[model samples]
Target: MQRVLMAAGISEDVVSQRPSNRQHRLVNKTLRRLEKLHEACADPRLGLKSSSPYLLELLPETASALRRVWEPYRGLGAFTGPAPGEDEAVFLGLHARTLLAQTDRALLLFKEAKEKMFDETSSYRKDLTKLSLLFSHMLWELKAIFPGDRYHGNTYNLTKTEARDFWKMTFGNKCLVRWSIFAEKLRCVHPFQEGLESVALKATLDLTCNDHVSVFEFDIFTRLFQPWGSLLRNWTQLAVTHPGYMAFLTYDQALSRLGRHPRKPGSYIFRLSCTRMGQWAIGHVTSEGDIVQTILENTPLYLALLQGHSQGRYLYPDGQDANPDLSALHRPDHKAKVKVTQEQYELYGKVGSSFRLCKICTQEEKDTRIEPCGHLVCRRCLDSWLQKSAGHTCPYCRCDVEDTEPVEVEPYQPKHKQEKESDTDDDHEDIELVVKQMASLRKKAPERKTAQQ
Candidate 1:
């Protein structure tokens, strides 16, 4: 269960002398690093691949001082969620507050983190300086543990640009999911310094929102938290209604079998999702001769998916019809399974383009920038739009346009005359049509339009 660190001077302290604040933080940083090394060694699923090039590297000097925590679980079982409860969080906050468990301290800390760190009006959302402050607040001793600590006296901290970009990415889309993804990414960026997962549950309070008391409040999460081992112990104990379920089949194992047998396209079997434990996923052979899988958290039985969705998905390895016996057990509520990214690829050609065309018609040069939503529209087209609607609307995001700005093009001071000639062309029928449309719109006194409503 433990590995003894053998060092001549590193004897256990006889005196109960309290460590200084800086020493405590430094030791915590070291302990965090050691924790990562131990997990890397224990989990073969990781393939010992360092998330960062600098992380998971062992130094001969620290070998004698490093201790290994016993980890018996591997593969699917390895994910024993860090802060599964108040106990785990209490264990983590021990060094600072020895009586953390005796009181409601763990709950308070988690509540504080949820409110101060991840709340909608959090200071990290304000600006870079505040975000950097958060970096220091936690066990993030970035400089001492990363590139800066050893190399050319370098001070490697996050830049304003990186800080701003991180905020946009993590808070840009869905609420909880973005933060979860952000936490995952933050782990890699600073992996060598200290681990993030051990502290993530505390940070996210096991993915609890600020207003909510527990994540178990959500039913989908209830199913998600219960690992597959609890549902059916082994293949022999399979109680799943979906006949396609080849119980406990790993993705690699399924892929190998399908490759060897060479089943027809759309042949699929329901298996435990590799990405999320306890979740049902389809390991199906696609028309493109590839085996693909995606975990659907909400739906337990993929029978509805089998019965309804074509998605090039057929039940069993032989592409046979669904067994009436299995279909009778649990009736599917939804018409069909929700489409995943790969499933949508067959229908959608391209997602989006790099060219900043007007999102309304998707055919004009974006000349006027709408404020708040930051959507761009051609000025003449926008004038007619404002006249008709009598209310400002950003056709792109559907946000009520508050203000407008003319998109200024910096004068192209090209070094070569040939470059200017090469850039300008007469072949743009699309651009000319847009230009004609811009000219035709009756010139309403050129003034900035402001729409509060």
Candidate 2:
């Protein structure tokens, strides 16, 4: 049995040995410190506090202390050593590192913004408020990234694609656009830093597709520089030489050309281009410390330059007028609303009536409808179904449904009774009172008769 357990990767000796008291104490101390830091960072009052300078100083010190507490347990082996607390210690260390990095990045941005603020800027307070909000947003992102022990190890080394998807899903498109602009600012401000451009470009492209070289295969070049160059090159070369690559490139080029056509006005391509232009404008204004003039004057010129750079010819041939009847193109269609058929209404009613009783328990009280599908289901029946099968579909129609708020239906009551019940309630109470009094008197009489006998 011991040999079998050893073969299964569990050593009895290692399992039997306990972590040292000193290691346990250290782990506990580190956890307490982390908990306190997390609570402080999560506190809403941190943002609302009047002393910004104090917070700026205190946060870094707290981050440094957290780093110091977790330094010794950074990569302690859990299985090989008698350190039972190693796993927890490592997880806490990674979480601390993530939080510390985020705090440092936010602080850098805050300090930069503060330096940019001048006496001429009347909206300094507003700018400071925006910076504070941005810092809070960064903290919120840290919470999401390091949700718990499960993600602590993996979040730090996420692939570019995974990071992009995570950002888009968590922060949304607007925030993603802002992040792109912010990354560009970071790249420009620290141009001398190694690999900053590549990192920024990768991040931007992950969020928004690159239009200029969207057709080319750049993965081959990236893989060629890696340690396993020969093997990767052979693999990537085969992919690049595949017949489908040419077909895909041709399709991509055709689509790109179509998108640039002036008359066609590709809405998606236009929106992407506009987003890029907006990012550029934001970076320019923020860095230059002249927001209004740059927006009013330079933005239009930049847009005009983009128009001039387009491959599509806006001019028509010979005697054709430029201002053709564009009104016809812009005309809005007034479509009438479609009404549901009587048959469909009757079907819905039948479905609703079937749920008057609980399907699982056969009780009469349950009457709730599933959302979007409008299929009726008893709450108890649904709960039982979820527990047994965990299925997310309407039982009657087998249509996919989400676990949303159930719409409850009141049990049918007679209209005449409902109206009269309110009036008769007081009378009913009085009659009940009289009956109770009579019953009490009868009981007393019986007792008195027994006493006389």
Candidate 3:
């Protein structure tokens, strides 16, 4: 059925007739040219592709037609959309310290991004649109690894029956059978509202990677350092609960699966350990650097270019170059590494002012009280009630607050700034710095502080 569909759509001439090596070469060259166009759009360092007719010829008519639409604005460089910059590094650091672990970083990032970019009155249409595109690209990369006859776009809606059919046809193994069934059922009965498919898609993509990597591994990295948001939460949760048979991981895992690993000292046999599951899944991302090195060394174009250029024959001993070794320069490790662009950082401050409380606070607690009527209160105000209160009255309004029913409140786990508040004026300064720094990183405002009444 798939073959029939392909033949009908691609045409009999293109499907059955295999291209000669020369033809294949031409196609590869064209793909490289297309890549140049993409590269040009991403970074200004690469000169424009318009100068060379050969490069111009490489782009398919369809892509070429859309070239103007894809072009970045003057002075804007290529529109890789908003990314974090050095100024926003403080917030990034705060995130590494705060919600990176035990929470959805991407959602946090997205919320911060949305807050930074848009506002309560501003719909997230633009942010979601870009995010949807990014997610589609990620899915495309995953699909490339696991070839399928039909690719439903990120928006492909599958009925429960169709999803079941998809799984049965794609993966008939017993272990995966249950997963497929569950996924199909989940599709029919999803957790979130009908809207926000794009948001859900991004989260699903991230969650798919997380499941393969294991939630723990991803969480650890995000918690301590990375400062992305969890824009991909609902979809990710859905994917986690009802993932496709194929597991996804970081780009590093894909490289490892392709049989590339770092060469240990004096060991002819490359290490191949037992396939074990980590916090995300039973996959590997530990040796992406080696795979990248191998691809660069083995590729003919790389060698030819090395000879063609001023640089002599060189070997990559370990793949830790701050800059890219190849022309495309989209390194797997670099792409995987989370760094905020300047736009993202500046925008964080703009958006951070929108939310009344930071997104992290929302996940744990938010709007549990109203001011006067049920005035705003943070963990500090509630701490006193921890000792004695079936229901504590609002400190501001003195209204009979019935919901103050404390249930053996756990000891307060001071956030990153709290522990540091004890040191000195410097320490207090540090806490303030951390709070101000987090302003950019957060989508919502920090919980307001108040004395216990």
Candidate 4:
């Protein structure tokens, strides 16, 4: 109950929850010492050398205290282990105290605006921006306490082809990125650091095909939530629904107004799906739950829709242009289908006899063939080659074949009784040839030796 009140802006003196004696003393000492440290650090006259000498005397004791306080606060275990004793009480109490203090400061600024009759002469816009920044921070910190730990590919490195695929999925086609502003800054810490190591994760989204990139970043001290779609939706909802917020701040002109704004405060709901092949990393944020749920609900189907539409198959294509040529590319298909003569095929076929083994597939088979330019490829290797090698020409001879198709092969029979006729033919040929040759050479043959009994 005291913790709740404290969170609700009650004073520490008014907190009825009694903490353990040791913890109470520890909290008071730490807070007081921390205040002193801040004070000393801020003093302009104190040089680093002088300050360090003074601080060194207290370092060992301070370090011990800091370690004691930090044990629970450093990890997920911070959420558990006991009832509201002094350490927990002080720690939780500080969060509310800080927010309440900031809220009061914001309210003071807001009151000043009202007193000035909402006039342009007042520093109200500046004050409002400050208030927004503070409120954003407060909300940010509250959410950070138990951040979603799901990883998304955004936090890690990617292969070029994989990146291209991701880019195509994220931004290409008829779908454009919805304009956004008033982004929440969030962060995640790299756990292992050597001596004040601060490795921070940067978040960004690339809207490809559309050719755009957006970025969001925060200090590594705060743990971050991943897939931030829901968080983004919630944050956007809060910013947008705060009626006339942008207008009041004189920032409406600066923000992107891509479409109609929502009038009420609520979650921006959507269905998402992500690919199974996508990589994931640690310390990602999700607005409400695991990122897998967001991916399952939003990404897959959205990508499929984007892909389908990009392929020129829309629900209502009747009013659209009949030609499927991409206006942006400016290249027409008329040049792709020039006719070639049968004599060219015959000439190539004759020259193709010397070819063996595919150049690309590199299979050591004699089943290779060539085109008019004498480029060689085995029949089995053409399909994959055609799929990826766009603006097609034969890899080996650079032949401009009008049309190429996959070669079909018949099934082979097993070596059984079906081979009897082939064996008989071979025997008949060998017998006659050998007998005639032996007769011709009979006069020159050596006599066989008698066997010893």
Candidate 5:
């Protein structure tokens, strides 16, 4: 694992050197000091006024350690240096650190805000609001750094405009303030609602946070310190004299499998598949459905280029032209006329219609498909029969079916497009109404208090 890390371009010197017993003792002492400080802060009687002299002294030391760990590879230049081979590993390490730091900082701020909110001080509300703003800024920074829905593990990356629109949908137009107000009001109504609101708020704050901190920390550590150590270990192992000293380490990493092309589908090629003396053959399909093989290259290049040309033929490695047989290329025409039965013809006729209502459901419903027996059934009806029946056969045909997977269909769109969709407009209006209702309820609360007096 250490050798793998080094080969992947992580520095060996940093990871290979084990800490001395004295250093371990120092770490233990520091941990004990931190634990004492934590206990002092946890005392409820001291509240926010809890202070530890040791904490004040230890913070500077912690910061110094952090700087030592991160300062060398803090910027883009760390990965863009002269060594092209190590660029990818360096970039991965840098990105991992950035993500770690951002998540940790956000979590710390969240914890601090939660603590401050329990205080009876008048400034707590204002401080909480400021924390909310800071959270929003952090969210924005995260989005900017890792732009697009693809980064969020979506199907594809979004354009700059789409990203802006996504940001608007998530946190735009005082959404945080509105959610906070709603949550506060809901607290008076139900405990479940309050819990739900708190969960939602926390989820919104850390959108893509994962519980794999240890894995990332280990990877970062390995990447930072294994390269030089690996070299030293390799040299020492090789230096040990023996009668049959066979060097086990071999350079076999150059071989790569560039996976199959989408057009060619299943056929794959490897980098080491090409031979220096092999001949390249080009197969062309003739008008009469015959393939003609011709020698494209006799003295071929050692490296294989798996990319396809404009004519849709992939450049592949071929064997030597030994005993060339043109008779193998002759293909007999086996085209047969497909005769549709009366029932199948009727089913085809039904499918050709503009609309076919599901016979099993209401007349207004159009979710219908023609079965093998030329009968139309709704998906729901078909699903019910498939579930309840032991045979799992088609409802109309009663044919012994092996599988009941639904056929893929193009998405249905209405012929007449709407001038303006009401759903989004209605949603916006509903939000406005809710905000107004909340404002009125707040006003009435004060009036009700006055009346009771």
Candidate 6:
């Protein structure tokens, strides 16, 4: 109950709960030391050390004049958005405690405006674009992704072809990147980081597609979630010799081009499908040296499945070079491998299952895919996150999640059920033997008094 209250911000730990005996003394001592630590700190060492001075070194009159500029916006939060706990944490650092008191005042003012003047209130505002602010030597950037925020307008949006080029050039052919199915049209990165880990699970979404924000199981260690900066790794050079995606070519043209190359059984070429924007047609030579073609879906997993069942081992234009050449997951050092021992399989399954669990609640599977970002999270968690967020942003990635769609995650099958049953039988036998031995031992043992003395 106390923990619940503390989490809800209704009560403090010291007020709702107390340590007994010596533990109480430790708590009081810790508080006293903390107070002393603050008291002994000098004014210069008090807050963040700015690299440069204030941008506006204004006189008293000038400051008042600046305040007057915002007078008209006083009813609309002075043209400000809701506070994100994080922006202040980065801007003021430890000094943000004083800013906390100001938040209540701000909330009260917003409420008073709503009550007194309904028509003038900010509550009815919609389609509010995500705003970013910059100040003096220290910059305060706010990324409060609300329901109607416009990331598509202010971000690096991409078309289907560009996104395809992105993949063919990088780890595009790899199974590890099957998660980037939604980063096609709109762009904005929500980096989820903890500790000093350089690689954070960054989520990107096409905000134009989805109508809501999203959340990801950021703590999941799957390779699918990588630093957004990884997208810049130059892999477009592969297309030069590979000739994988030959744009502006018809089926006959692709076939004509492949005919000129060496008559390798597995050699193939891909041309943009005339029907749709992101679709492609794969023209490949059969084992019998006859040409065959099929439409390729705009999904990495589908392409991977096709490759797995292909007559040729290598990618198009390079038979025997193999699709593995473009896959980082098949590398010797990669955690995910094609083959493993039975023990390794079970161990990986166990670990993978845990990783797939929703880190937010730690009780459900992250089986629902949030649109635009394509982040998998539980419905229960996503709904709860949406309710509490003043402006709906993902708790993990902090992305502007617009909508969610339910998805099917393959259930993990552990190979230890039979072994567990045998172990249980052994445990039962051991328990029976222990009980008999204890009975015999008790008959030969001396009695003892039950009194405290």
| Candidate 2 global TM-score | 0.22
Q: CA lDDT, every prediction?
A: 0.35, 0.32, 0.28, 0.29, 0.30, 0.33
lDDT per residue (tens digit) for residues 248-276 in model 6: 45445556666754567667766434332
Whole-structure CA lDDT of model 4: 0.29
Per-residue lDDT of candidate 3, residues 217-291 (tens digit)? 222222211111221231232133222112332333334443333442110111111121111221211223233
Candidate 3, residue 180: Cα displacement in angstroms equals 15
Q: Rank the candidates by lDDT, best first.
A: 1, 6, 2, 5, 4, 3
Best by lDDT: 1
**Per-residue lDDT of candidate 2, residues 1-453 (tens digit):** 344323323334322223344444444554454445444444453343333223354444444544444444344533233232332333232333334444444444435655443221335434433433333332333333334412232223221222223333442322112233434443442232347545534433332121111101121111111111122222222222211111111112223333333343211111111111111111111122221111111112222223422533212211123312212211122111112233323433443422234444656444444433444446667656655655666555555543222233333333434332221101011223334545777788889999999
lDDT of 2 at 78: 31
Q: Per-residue alpha-carbon lDDT of model 5 for 94-169, expressed as tens digits?
A: 3334334443443454356565544534354334223323223323323333244112212222221222233345
Of 1 and 4, which scores higher on TM-score? 1
Per-prediction CA RMSD (Å):
22.4, 23.2, 28.3, 26.2, 30.5, 24.5
Q: What TM-score goes with each of the models? A: 0.27, 0.22, 0.19, 0.21, 0.18, 0.26
- Candidate 5's C-alpha lDDT? 0.30
Task: Name every residue pair that clashes in candidate 2.
Answer: none
Cα displacement (Å) at residue 424, model 2? 51
- Which lDDT tens digits does candidate 4 get at residues 125-217? 445443443343333323233124211213321212222233344433211121221011121211222222111111113111011122111
Model 3 TM-score relative to the real fold: 0.19
Clashes of each: 0, 0, 44, 13, 8, 10
Angstrom error of the Cα, residue 370, model 2: value is: 9.7
Residue ranges of candidate 2 with Cα displaced over 4 Å? 1-127, 145-453
lDDT of 1 by residue, 1-453 (tens): 011111111112311122223333434455554444344334443233332111233221122222111111112323232221222121122222321111123233334554343332344222212221222212122122222222111222211222223434543321122233434554454341234433433332232222211211122222422222221222112232335655334455566556643447666666544444335566667777677766553233433354434444664443556532433223322111111122122211232321345545667755555543444566667766776874556554556654443442222332433444331111112334444444544242243232322
Instruction: Say which prediction, candidate 2 or candidate 3, comes out ahead on TM-score.
Output: 2
Q: Of 1 and 3, which scores higher on lDDT?
A: 1
Give the Å shift of residue 38 in candidate 4. 32
